[model samples]
Target: MWEKGYQTPIYLFNKLIGLQAVVEVVSNHTSNALELLAKQHSQMKTFVYQNQLALDYLLSECCIEIDDYKKTIRRLAAKIKKVAHVPLSKGCR
Candidate 1:
């Protein structure tokens, strides 16, 4: 036998409304988290770009210094060759 008083339409409607409220709350939380993540990703990308530019500048400076060092060495070797009578191929006995 079905209990007529227990299976009311209004009770079922109220339950559905409560479930809808819960779903809305969960959806709002998810949206807020997604927005936060997007902002963090953007900030990370900018930081990486700045670091890359700094690294590139440092590498360029190192290359310029290395070139200057090579030139200086070449000049010194040429002066040594002019002063020494021994040929470099003979390995300075």
Candidate 2:
């Protein structure tokens, strides 16, 4: 899960760097400069949105895991409370 989750950010970083290189090369005088720029802009927008969606999905999964863990802790807390008059020790006392 960790590996998959980090893939999106890595992919986005590489794409941005690659596109920036392309933009720099095309910075010189050219008749289709505007057209090329427009295309790149659209492509960049798509890439950004796709990466965002992937990240969002990963975050949602992480949230679900967090909620699950919270529930488990709550359940354990309830069990501990039932078994003892005082709460669990704060440290290894």
Candidate 3:
């Protein structure tokens, strides 16, 4: 879930970078449009950096959650196994 949620923005940022590259290629032929595309490209680059930071943070959090969940499952399994191995003594119902 976390991956899906964060991947969209990262993907979009990559597309933006691609688009900026294409714009830059065209900007080489037009002096007037170069300045505008440059500004937008700069802002997009900043957003890409920020998005990367956010994705890193989200990945760390997801890792922590997965680790904790694995630990809990192991603990529960051990407890269940121990109970299953215990002898049933003769006692009053």
Candidate 4:
């Protein structure tokens, strides 16, 4: 999805990844309920472990992505300011 050439593909990818992580975490927590629900509907069961390490990893990744995006915006803003301040050449009408 990132290679489609949209200017904000990174941001979109990051958001999707973050959403997936959250959904996984939530799905894991509610595994038993879901399994029971599936049983009622004659469907497959699902299981998820309640592990601190996994949650920590997801949280860290989210934090890192947020920081990276912020840094990118700051860099872009600085470059924009530089371009915006450049005076026109004498030859220009």
**TM-score of each model, paired residue for residue:** 0.55, 0.31, 0.32, 0.28
Clashing pairs in 4: none
Q: Mark the regions of model 3 whose C-alpha exceeds 4 Å error after superposition.
A: 1-29, 61-93
Model 3, CA-based lDDT: 0.52
3 or 4, greater by lDDT: 3
Q: Using lDDT as the measure, what is the rank order of every candidate, best first? A: 1, 3, 2, 4
Q: lDDT per residue, candidate 1, 1-93, as tens digits?
A: 437755677667667666766666665555555555555666676677667678879776422111123344444544544443223235422
lDDT (tens digit, per residue) of candidate 2 on 1-93: 557655687687767666755554444323244445545656676677777678879786422111123344444544544443332246613
Q: lDDT, candidate 1, residue 45? A: 62
Question: Which tens-of-lDDT digit does each residue in 59-89 have in candidate 4?
Answer: 7632211112334444454554444343435
| Collision pairs in model 2 | none
- For model 1, the superposed segments whose C-alpha errors exceed 4 Å read 1-6, 60-93
Report the number of the highest-lDDT candidate.
1
Question: Which candidate order results from sorting by TM-score in descending order?
Answer: 1, 3, 2, 4
Q: Is candidate 2 or candidate 4 better by TM-score?
A: 2
Single out the weakest 10-residue window by summed lDDT for candidate 4: 41-50
Evaluate residue 63 in candidate 4 and report its C-alpha lDDT on the 0 to 100 scale: 21
lDDT of 1: 0.54
For lDDT, candidate 1 versus 3, the one ahead is 1
